[model samples]
Target: MQATFLIYSFLYLIVLIFLLPFEYFKRPASLRKRWIREKFGFFKKNEQIETFKPKIWIHAVSVGEVVAVSRLIKELSSKCEIILSTITDTGQKIANDRFKNYNVKVIYIPFDIPFAINKALKHFKPLAVILTETELWPNLIRIASKKMPVILVNGRMSDKSFNGYSKIKFFMKPLLKRLTLLCVQEEQYKERFFNLGAEEQKIHITGNMKFDIELREIHFPWENAIAQPVILAGSTHEPEEEIILDAFLKLNITGSLIIAPRHPERFQAVETLIKRKISESSREISFSKLTEMPSAFSFKSSTSVVLVDQMGILGSLYRICDIAIIGGSFIAHGGQNPLEPAYWRKPIICGPFMYNFPFIEEFLNHEACIMIDKASLLEILKELAENSELRQTIGNRAYQLFLNKSGATEKTLRLIEKVIP
Candidate 1:
């Protein structure tokens, strides 16, 4: 079964290489590493660390996972030498920037081929391997388990993902059993993993690592200068921006509307949408020009919208928002993280697609957050904007919920210590 799975994995990689266009291959270095696997070797020569002895290796796939485990990384650094690996360039960038001061090495995870997995293991020789979220690379898990302990931290299994894996349960069962522990984010995820042949004794509910992120004070350039209520539409996707703009026009509130698209590549597209919606009387503000305006003028004028075209600023930008409309929920894209806004004590408004984050739904239920389905967004926005008392009440409740869930980082770090040699 393992041999057949390995053959199928190779075929899948071949299909991906052929189907994806050359231009779409944005990360040349990653592609090069994969191609090296097809030729003389699986892992790149440079990926091998000769002298660095890592106590633990943590794999975080992308930006969300990187942010989720960042606090845990800091806490675990005291006891172990941490090696962080990510598949995406954005994740690598975030990890490098965040862990620059610490004794951490960030590397790109090689392809999941057997040779690549073996090579990575032989070089790092980590005491244990920890994977964040739903990163289940079969070969990596199998090979790493042979030499050292392997665990999944902040593990979660969506119903859709679970169903997909169940089809290959014959191959998946052994892969799962090799894990030393499965630190799950929620009880439902824990139960689902167990149903899919995961050992019950290996699973534990550690809560979402995102809740573990500490809220830092962000000093917005307009913090003291602006009194106008700022409405932040964060991590928004296509079509949703149109809905938000229409709702914003209806409210006609005396404030700035900041739209931060989920992907940096969508900046120009979102900017175009905002330009089309804004009236000729209103001016759009850019972050670059934020310093030119006078203290009073920053809040006084009819600057209708601000487009956040850069990365690494959305979380900090949330500090200035009076109300937050989290994107990705409007359409059926499952939702983006809402905890950032909740941490900042801002009342959150999201669309109805939130299955990816069940804990967030629980938080919203307890806090009485403003939830608007795709159809009723306009009405919800108008009501929230008009009623100051209602918005503040919900905002305060959201912050209180954050305060209650503050210790997940400490809890997760303690678990890491138990596993590390």
Candidate 2:
């Protein structure tokens, strides 16, 4: 096993080196620098010479995971010194902004090479390693297991992931057994882990921490910004904007529309597409980014489509929407997040390809939300626009379900304590 992981690490290093040229040119400056520094275990000045008492290293890959572990990090920080690490620049930016006041030391997680992991382990001196959902790196976990507990928090394995893991049972068994603990999202996920060779004693079902979502749209002036019923194509993907824009023109729904593309890099592309589509509409369609609008927003009565070209604002934007069409589900990217709209107690609609979030099945099964193909999306939007009572019932049902599933953070904290304590 040791020999295999070493060879794996060597091959991985080579592959990264090979891809570096392309990545360096293509990615953002901050991201490229962060990736390079993290690849070689470069630590900042403050990261060096920290307090020596039992440090808990919390690793969340990006924004979603970083945000999910907020309550967990907050609760655990008081108990033990915290060292938070992320893989992406956006995640790093968000982590720094969110936890800037907190005493937690935030840094980038090194690439999964043995030497890089060794350097991180030496500097941080974490008493325990708490990994967020589905981040099972072989070399890092294998090395850390020797010095301290390597626990998996908010662990979940989707069917697509399970099938891939099952094929590599030989490599996975040893990796699974090294985990000091496993806090999974659902009971069914336990069986999937076992099939992938996790020890039964190590696994515990703890639901999703996302359900315990602690965000406030309390400040967003919905009444001022939203003149009429609005349809928000929140977190949309490539070509999704065109389809939804077509639907909006046809419906002539006499309301505002906001399309927030999933990636910031695509904001210009979406903006251009929306501008072209607005040419076909007889009703004057106004287009603007969130930043372009006035602070004391008074939305225009004429048909308007606002392209949300910013970050950390989408969750708050949900409060202003009458209906939400989640992105990524329409394409093979799986889905962005239907849960955000649900958090705002708004009626949500998504596409058929939501394999990325199978946990949402129970919510969809109970008809708390609607999932339709891209072709049928217009029909449902039209129906929901007309039927006030139906929209209220569906939104209320999803909201109730979201409230009921709120204790995962508490459950996860209890289990995590058993290891770090």
Candidate 3:
């Protein structure tokens, strides 16, 4: 099984090298040696290696996974030298920022190629490799398991991902067996992992670490900060933004609309859409140029939209929002994390495609959230925005739900401690 995995890894490496030109042209900065060293598995000789031996290596694929496992990292840092690795630039930045004060080293996980993965493992020499969510790198898992224990923390297996993995059951069965322990987010996820060849004795329901994140009070210092009741369309995709803008336009209330796109590259696109739509509206105002101080309710009826062109602020923005419309659901991206807004005690509105978050969907169905199909979003937003009492009622229910689900972090940490030798 290991030999076959190595052969596959070698073939995958050849494919990656063959497609290097395309990746280089698409993102030259991303493929730079220094950037690759930091973001990918490539390491630099000049870069100083930490003197302290890292006891555990934690891998989070991107920003969402990083945010999901951050609290657990904090807890594990005290007893172990945590080595954090990410696949994206944004995830690396967040990991570095969050772990700067701790005894943690942040690096990019190398390609799943055998040589790259082996090189990284030999250098880091961690006691265990801890992967967040579903980052199942075949070569990495196979090689690391031969040297040190590999554990999956805060694991979640969506039905879609499960079906995809099940097709390659023969290849993944051994990979799943390499995991020393599997700390999953939910029992449903445990069952999914079991179906995918995970050892049932190794699986534990640790709950969702996202529910474990500590909600910090956000203070927006902008002069024309959104003071009046605001509705945030967070992590919206291309067509979803237009839909949200249209819904906000038909709303009966005089409040601000904040649109936060999921990807940073989409910032400009979202900004352009906001400009075009607001220009056509009769009483539209953009908050991007709000430079001067204004009374709390002064710009209540003035600014119609605020495009959050920055990243890492959406979670904070949710704290002050009266209602939240989670994006990606309407357009079939399986939806962004609705738990972020739910933590703020704000009433959430999402489209129908929420299979990625089955537990959240179940909670919403039980009145923990407000579900709106694409066709009904406009009417629901209009109703919620017009009635402050109704918004508050739902918001309070969502907040309670968030509080009820708050112990996942602690539960996850306990499992990590038990496995992290």
| TM per prediction | 0.89, 0.95, 0.92
Candidates 1 and 2, the one with greater TM-score: 2
Ranking by lDDT: 2, 3, 1
How high is the lDDT of residue 256 in model 3? 80
- Residues 1-421 of candidate 3 have per-residue lDDT tens digits of 7577768877887898887666545554644665555434556554435666556889999888988888878888887787788877778777887778987888878878766787777677788898988998887888898887889988888777898999989988878998998988888899989988999999998777787766567666653456466888898888998998887877746678878888877787877887888788877565562223234424444556777776676787788788899889998788888888878778889898877677776667668688778789878877877788888788788778777777877876776667665
Clashes of each: 0, 0, 1
RMSD of 2: 1.8
Residue pairs in candidate 1 whose N, alpha carbon or C atoms collide under 3 angstroms: none
- The model with the greater lDDT, 2 or 3, is 2
Total backbone collisions, model 2:
0
Candidate 1 lowest-lDDT run of ten: 283-292
C-alpha RMSD of each candidate structure in angstroms:
3.4, 1.8, 2.6
Candidate topping lDDT: 2
lDDT of 1 at 412: 68
- Candidate 1 versus the native: TM-score? 0.89
